[model samples]
Target chain A: MNQISDLITAFLEQCERTPKHIAFSQDDRQISYQQFEQRTKKVAGYLTGSNQCIAIAMDRGIDAAIAIYGILRSGNSYLPLDINNPANRLNFIIADAHPVYIIGIGPCPENINIDSQETQWLDLRDLLISDFSYRNVQIKTDAIAAILYTSGSTGTPKGVALSHKAITNFATWAGTTFNISQSDHIASLAPFHFDLSIFDLFTSLSCGAIVSFIPNRLTLSPSKLTQWLCDNKITTWYTVPSLLSFIALKGSLETRPLSDLKQILFAGEVFPTPQLIKLTTLLPNVNLYNLYGPTETNVCCYWPVITKQLQADKNIPIGIPACNAVLTIDKTTHELLVESDNNFSGYWQNGKLNTVTFKPQGYATGDKVSINAKHEYCYHGRLDRMLKCSGYRVEPAEIESIINQLEGIETSVVIGLKDITSGQRPAAAVVIKKGHTLTHIIKPLRQKLPAYMFPCKFTELSAIPLLSNGKVDYLSIEKKLTH
Target chain B: MKPKIREFIFQELIFVANPDQFSDDDDLLEAGLDSMGIMRLIMFIEDNFGVTLPDEEIDPDNVQTLNALEKWILRHKK
Candidate 1:
């Protein structure tokens, strides 16, 4: 096994050895290692900025992959902007990250709000500049590689800065643990902005495996996604459990036997045991695993599913530590604390490093947990107000903050409702003024928030429910909504 | 039947910039109707139409369009 301290060095070595090996493949397009290296180099050649932050705004494609790798090669960190996000949200990230270069033909400050005139837009169509004279920049192992944005409690998205050392360690650990090799065909199912893409884009490339990008359209019909996985002969698949659970329920696993699929890894949220059980039974030959981590720490722990001990009602145990994660449970709160080489360097916001208030030992994981007799981590909900609407971490305060700003909304409280498919969906319980109706605020509120964070249900209330100590009565509202 | 499916999809399932202009034949998946939305949509169909669409039959041909969803529901409806 080769020693991997950095991603670029590992990728360069892989390319040199197996230039003919296919690196990335999409619907009709594919790129070899040699071609990918050249393309990434060409992309790096286009940038003239000394400011080492570049924002990429494109859908999940082979080009997006090249753009990301190219940005990394240029000794710059890449921030992926989900094109589906609202302009306000995208603007907030752009303003926060202070990215000098924005790649891909996405949203621009076209007379709306040019927060920075120094911003340069490079269209995705013209990404491959003809100039070959590009000077290579040296990247330190601790240099930020990717900055991923997640919903913040303070009414906006916060960027989690991941170092090259962080990703390389995690991805290398993943590649080694999964026994991935040149022959394995991996699937990239998550969007570029999501943390799950870290494994798909980096680990597969590092292992000299062909990573195939699947589109969102195929997911509407799980059968189509299943067929694509089988037809493409994807050997390994990793994604959030919600989509996988849907596939197991609706994809007719009996008709389409996925012979080539060797293993499946689910992360970002707890897999309901019933669905996990179905996947194990349906794909009897394939191995199943549950990886546990936040975006701040990329995959700190994992469990290889033991189907014999599976129960429908019980939660799956998050396995023992991996990837050199130093874990210590908070005795008082039972909150899981993790420290590792894979832990993110820091949280970034608007050209400044935000303090995460890390303790001497580890970063507080917000989740309340119990160490079972088997010595595995059993998750109990969050210690904070954060909720996972499916795999996307949502802060009700963020949604409520937006809703309160709208007209006719006296005071809005956003709460997560129980959902079968998605773990939870954010619903708004609004206190409206006498003269106005809820309809006026709907359109504007939708524009301010992303689709995932948008409240699925809105119930109009006469007044805000309050506790004895003057706190918002969330428990009362939850009972009212469900009943 | 088409209106009911269309209403449910537009109201709760998918999000499009100009939903009113969105046609009945428009693809819901492309407009951001994900797997979660599909599951909720199936449940809605069973409750409203009193028809249980088999798990294996939840293919693109049945749920891709408003017209397709209506046909799929009506075929099983008494």
Candidate 2:
């Protein structure tokens, strides 16, 4: 069995043999195999023998890619911090990771500086220009390759440690399943921090296909996105349902028939049946796939969206497990349990592997599911405090923690309220710190949380309902919101 | 002015807003044309008109009525 290092070596060899082939594209800039490999080596050289985590606080572009590959080559895990992250959150993450090095395309925060120990700060453009040769270094399969931090249920971000073997396994499976090859051109739509982007980056690299990073501004504009897709002749598109719905609802598909687009894979949320029907009508030749998984499990199950079949039965099953991924259901609870090569080793910081939830046999996913007569598994809902409302996963604890951060909030509880129009909306019931208006508290909360995570309804309470154990009574809050 | 454009706008407004009642000049933001809904409308205009609308042109006033959208489309027509 070839290890991840072997995969990288093979890819590098292919690049050397065909140095003219385009490896990455961003805006007007394109990087060939020769240039990519040479720059990757410089990054590796700079990071080699570094026994500390490296934080990449750079914009989403070519430099970010090089830094990631460099961290991998240097035998240390890379942590990606969004350039637009709140200063306090960024500080918290930097403090938690305790990164010995920081790479930035622009200026670092003026207020907070990493002065402790030896913290080297390097400009990405300077590093890319430096000439360096590739070094021969062996990498262990189980070694941590990257630590992806996701918004946790407790409001604090948790780092998911991924191994080289796990990433390689996912890449191999994705490349083969999607029929990725040298002829393919895939769009890199998701942000670097988002785990879904890994599929776009590594899968394209493994197959020797072109990976183009779409700018964030273009992604927000429906018209620009449509033009870019058509102009670039993007063959494969991997994005969230939100963007896909934007296209469908905006009617961009009608004018610009994505004729060149052969595959459209959507994950990170439930694809609405109405929008799915519209997409099929617009692009009849394109194959649509609904991928299902959490950040922890990189695409364990997939359901091919056959427009005619899915239209007949409103509910779409998440489908069967991918190659090398095993799925089982807890007979009593019906909670989905997943065992896969792509499963993260464990969360960082706490250093406690969740062996109770995840045994050597498999990890018990908190999502509830049901198997149909055809033996296909369908996602029902989560059994935990997490809620999937309008395609974005909202952790109540995370929202509560943010609410608690406000000065005038004594305590708070966040819960999901199902509505007829929008599938579910987040509602917050707060106990204020005496003489504070709900409006005053809500204004600040909106600025702090993302648009999707914002509470649509605010209910003021004297005190947050608590259970016998003194924990916030989520069920009582839900009932209050529902009523 | 084409009635197809007006009909499309009205139909989309109904689909997105799902209001108990609404007037042609009703503010979209007030009528529940949230960020997600606005995105959907933007796509609708592009597909139907074969013209890409910029983010600056996607305000509530520009999409509140058939007249507003038709005027905007006419100005930006390729």
Candidate 3:
């Protein structure tokens, strides 16, 4: 099981050794390693075709898990699509990726401009029930494992293509670094589309540990999330910092002793100092880690937040790079450049953008970091207009593009305002046409954007203030919000 | 049980239309209440009504509409 060449091999080896052990679990339902192997094999059998990529639009459950493994087992890469996303965004991804098969429970999106002749819709439930089974399809190490789409600054969603090598490398590094073993019950909190899920999925599988997924419905309910951790006896937990904060403040974590919960790894955004302190106070014995990286580079740097280290400084460092990752700061702009084998291959189908995004060494993370006297990387802030909202990476320009499309909207600017509860939320300020009220464009805006992208608040202005360089005066806008 | 909850929702979720235009049966999610909005609404309810909502009570059947949320508040009230 330790001879990890690729994810499929690592998973299969685990299945061979611990066939009866539970690999994944949902509410009451558990899928053993043997059952997971067989289910994925059935999916792989159906996936035998000319299609190189399969789009999975299933709900966040065992079906989605099986479909992903099945795609990999069939020598095809998976493209995880959130069916909850607006029809426009889904359709756009389908058109761009040109996935040969879409496995999900929902009806086909209307006006889907994909080639109906080539594209086949495989019902996930039917596949789960089917008896069709096949052996693993050999996949090249360099071949893509998955393509996770992220918000692009240029209006269109860009897919970050991760290869089998890249994923396996990171998983190996994480599994060893964290000492994730069969005894650990890992909690899979993030969705499949998000990169955080990769660590949760692979690290658990690689170690032959049980990966318990927190239901999407329960994610918003902080009390339920903490309760789930306690009930499942999840030893190793990895998720966004906001979820931890929510549980600490809103949920009843302090009331009960979650003795089984040992490690809490948080990433995607800066954990608020006060909230982190509160969490540490509650879970005194728990090992806390701050994992940092964009989708393109998985988790490159990790900080083990020891209580002694925290008593001196309120700011948590991003810490040293992972075994396979190298981080260098640009002397000019202080932008963080991450070089790692875990770096994504490139953006899907956007060769022009890919050249700009990926360097020969690694990917250019738009985040800026400062090195302290401790030689640890401390997150300053994002250099670009992109924002991390409720653990999702968002490009403000993308929101602005959607806003500008509305009739009677002259110009719009979206900014992430710091919030005590949910890290940062997007707030939009706009200037509208003379006759139009705010109500006229809000509905259309909602139709186009997802909830996380929705502006927490909207402000009207006669004219959007601009700096001497003609860019929107963001400083003035922040000042206005604070006032 | 409370008009202020509805008022706060309308004010907070400015994307939604006037509160008077909608019936209690209207799906707040469909109307523009996202997951974050739901949390905000829960916080408002907890602070004003002095009620703590269980995780199981936050399902669509209990919180999707104004009527359901009102019923939830009444049931969970301290």
Best by TM-score: 1
Best by DockQ: 1
- Give per-residue CA lDDT, model 2, range A1-483, as digits (tens): 254442355567568667888989998999987788778888887665643478798777788988887877777778887655555666667777777678987556663466556566777777766766556677777777677777688688788777777787888888888898888888887778877888886888777888888876564456567778888889998888767766765535677887788898888776767777777887899998988888777788998876767662375789889747899898888888889988887776632223225765587778899988878889887888787655556687887898899978898888877633234567888888877776666556544665556676667788888899998887888777655
Cα lDDT tens digits, model 3, A1-483, are: 344556899888878889999999998899999999888888888777522778888666788899999889888889999777887887888877878888887666554445656678878777767777675477788788888999989987888888888999999988898898888999897889989899877878878999988877666566777778899999998888877876776567667668998898998888887778888888998999999988888988989997767742466899989857878888898889888988887777622124235555467788888988989998888888888887899999889988998998998988988865556888888899998988766667777787778886787888888999998899888776545
lDDT against true structure, model 3: 0.80
Off by over 4 Å in 2: A1-7, A111-115, A130-134, A350-357, A389-392, A417-425, A450-452, A465-483, B1-37, B40-78
Clashing pairs in 2: A250-B43, A250-B44, A251-B43, A251-B44
Q: In model 3, how large is the Cα lDDT of residue B6?
A: 75
* Backbone-clash count (model 3): 0
* lDDT against true structure, model 2: 0.72
Q: Candidate 1 residues A165-192, lDDT tens each?
A: 9999999999999999999999898888
The collision pairs in model 3 are none
Q: What is the TM-score of chain A alone in each candidate?
A: 0.97, 0.91, 0.94
Instruction: Write down the RMSD of all candidates, one decimal each.
Output: 2.9, 6.3, 3.1
The 0-to-1 C-alpha lDDT of every candidate, in the order given, reads 0.83, 0.72, 0.80
Better of 1 and 2 by TM-score: 1
**Model 2: DockQ against the native?**
0.10
Give me the runs in candidate 1 sitting further than 4 Å from their true place: A49-51, A105-114, A125-127, A355-357, B1-33, B44-67, B76-78
